[model samples]
Target: MHGCFWHRHPGCPKATTPATRPEWWQRKFDGNVERDRQQMDRLIAAGWRVGIVWECALGRKADGALIDRVEAFIRHGRDLRAEWP
Candidate 1:
């Protein structure tokens, strides 16, 4: 699964959230998103396949893109598969 590391385990060695202030954390999250976008673009430009797994896409819902998420994973062999609580 491909996703911002922070969203996976915030404060993990591979992830982090700004701690100086709450707003800093928000900016940090935004930066992570932008960085992830750039990384995807770079990977695509390099001819590598990229699949995104968003934190919110894992929920079962009456009206949602859950099927799309499954299809993406099945067809692409990758996903931003975050196990949200």
Candidate 2:
């Protein structure tokens, strides 16, 4: 699972930048995003499905339904790419 802050999940409140070092943080986040994209691309090219499960989705109080969804994806999902809420 990827941390929402590090992966910069769109519209996620956890994806926040520190006020002290805006430029540095942006560069770091950008690098992380780029690396993730490149890795996913490579995996896709190798004929492997990819799924991103944000850390926030598996909260401290994770439920059975969410676990089932993840399990289902791993077992039978056909999509090349998917992101969990």
- Model 1 superposed RMSD (Cα): 8.4
lDDT of 1 by residue, 1-85 (tens): 4443554444345455455796977777777767776887788688666655544434465434665555655587553332322
Candidate 1 vs. true structure, TM-score: 0.44
Steric clash pairs (candidate 1): 1-79, 52-80, 53-80
Given candidate 1, what's the lDDT at residue 77?
55
Give the poorly placed runs of model 1, Cα more than 4 Å off. Answer: 2-20, 59-85
By TM-score, the best candidate is 2
Minimum summed lDDT over a 10-residue window in model 1 is located at 76-85
Per-residue lDDT for 9 in model 2?
A: 96
Candidate 2 TM-score over all chains jointly: 0.92
What residue pairs are clashing in model 2?
none
Among all candidates shown, the one with the greatest lDDT: 2
